[model samples]
Target: MHILKKGLVILFGSILLSIGINFFLVPFELLDGGIIGVGLIIKYLTGMKPGLAIIFLSIPIFALAWFYNKSYFYNSLFGMLFSSFVIDLLSFSRGYIQLQIPPVVSSVFGGIFVGLGIGIMLRYETSTGGTDLLAQFLSKIFKINVGIMIFIIDALVICLGGLLISKESFFLSSLTITVVALFTSLCTWNDERTKLKTS
Candidate 1:
């Protein structure tokens, strides 16, 4: 039952992520951070599929997880692959759905959806791997807050995307990631509360 529930959550989260990326972010050439941002940069530059790029880029990260954290490897493997497949499957939606909203609005909504997806999966003890897994590994070693580590990695990715894409992409993606962080924090806020209550 627990496994089934987690699978469902992954499915739902992947769908939300797909919607954010395909219908919202991709339309405006906006970006999120982590491997997603790197994937988007590759997509924008080489016309490669972002999902495929994500999978390819995650190889090294997954290799690290396999050796250092077998549990993380198992937890995130399906989430990453399924989410990537869903993103590719939904890529056609970009051509069909016209949001007709301001770019800022789109960016905000995109962040909301993406953040919610990531947060929900994380709350369930699963994730789409990539830099999220990397951040987790690093945080354990360095005794840093995972959130802070993630933020730094995300900021670097956003900056890289902006440099490769455009200044507008930089500024707007910064907004998008800020909103993403806010919503992700909101969703995962229960963790702190639970810890406090138990203490």
Candidate 2:
């Protein structure tokens, strides 16, 4: 029953992520951070599918997880694969998901949806891997806060993406990541509260 519940959560999360990417970000060439940002950069440059690029890019990170953190490897592998597949499967929706809202509105909503998806999965102790997984590993080794590492990585990705894509993308992506961080924090706040009470 627990495994089934986790599977369902992962599926739901993946759907939300795909919707955000296809419906909101793609329209304006906006970006999110982490591996997703890298994937988008590749997609924008080579016209390749972001999902495919994500999978290819994650191979080395996943390999490291397999060797050093088998538990993380198991937890994130399915989530990553499923999410990547869903993102690619929904890629066609970009053409049909036209919204009349401003680009800022789109970026905000996109961040919300993406953050909700990621946060929900994280609450269940699962994730779509990529840099999130890498951040965890590095945090363990360096005794740094995982959140800080993730922020640094995300910031770098956004900056790189902005430089390569456009100035507008850089600014909008900055807003998007901020919103994503807010919603993700909200979603996971209960866990932190529980830990605080216990500790």
Candidate 3:
């Protein structure tokens, strides 16, 4: 029962994230960081499917997770898979999701939705793989916070994306991803505090 609930949470969360990416971000040529960011770069540069690129790029990160943290591997495996699938499924709607809102609105709201999805997955002890796995590993070894590591990694990716995309989109995408990371950190903080208090 618990597994079923977790699966559903991940599934729904991934779907929302997919919608945010395909419906909002991709339409505007906006990018986020991590594997998804790279996938967007590939899609823009090579005309390949972003979802396919995401799955391929995430393999190494997932393998790292599998070797280092068994629990993380088990939890995140399905979340990554489901997210990849959902992203691909939503790809058909690319550039077609009309909204009355402005580009900035899309960036803010899209980041929020993506962050919420990621946070829910984390709440269940699962993940969406990609640089998130790398961030966790780095945090443990370097005595940095995972959220900070994630922000740095994502920032780097956004910079690279800026080179590939327009400056305005790059800045907006960076802003969006900043909010996404912030929201994720906020969501996970209470859990960490609770654990610390209990311990």
Candidate 4:
């Protein structure tokens, strides 16, 4: 029952993420930060699928989660897999529905959807891995806030994406990531510290 609940959360979260990416971001060639951004760059360069790239790229991140935090690994593994699958599934629906809006509106709304998906996963004590594991590890070692760590790593990824891709992609991606960061931070703040007290 617990497993099913978590799986459902990840499933819905992945759907939202896929909607943000395929319907909004991908059609515009807009990049996002973190592993997704890296995968996008790889796809742009190699004509490979982003979902496949995500699965391939997540291995190392899952490995890190395995070694650093077993709970995190177990929680995130299925979430990552299911999210990747959903992304691929929804990618096919790209032609059916698209924003056709301006880049700025798309970026903002796309970020909201992406962040909400991630927040739902995190709220359920699961993750989609990638820089999530990195941020967790850094938080453990550096005593920094987990959200802050994630933001920093995302910023670095955006910067590298800028240098690797075009400056326009970098700028748009940064906007997307910034909104995602803000929403995720707001959603996850103090979420884990609350507990029920039995009388």
How many pairs collide in each candidate, listed in order? 0, 0, 0, 0
Best by lDDT: 1
For candidate 1, the C-alpha RMSD (Å) to the true structure equals 1.8
Residues 35-94, candidate 1, lDDT per residue (tens digit)?
998999999999999999999999999999999889999999999999999999999866
lDDT of 3: 0.82
Q: What is the TM-score of each candidate against the true structure?
A: 0.93, 0.92, 0.92, 0.91
Ten-residue stretch with the least lDDT total in model 3: 139-148
Give the clash total for candidate 4. Answer: 0
Give the least accurate 10-residue stretch of model 2, judged by summed lDDT. Answer: 143-152
Candidate 3, after superposition: displacement of residue 89 in Å? 0.6
RMSD of 2: 2.0
Candidate 4, residue 65: how far the Cα is off, in Å: 1.9
lDDT of 4 by residue, 1-199 (tens): 9988987899888988888888778876777677877777887778788888988998988887778779998888888888878888888887787666998788888888888888778778787788876776786578665666777877887788788777887888888988887777676766634421221
Candidate achieving higher lDDT, 2 or 4: 2
Model 1 regions more than 4 Å off: 139-145, 192-199
Candidates' lDDT values, in order? 0.86, 0.85, 0.82, 0.79
Candidate 1 vs 4: which has more TM-score: 1
Error of 3 at 147 (Å): 3.2
Report the alpha-carbon TM-score of model 1 versus the true structure: 0.93
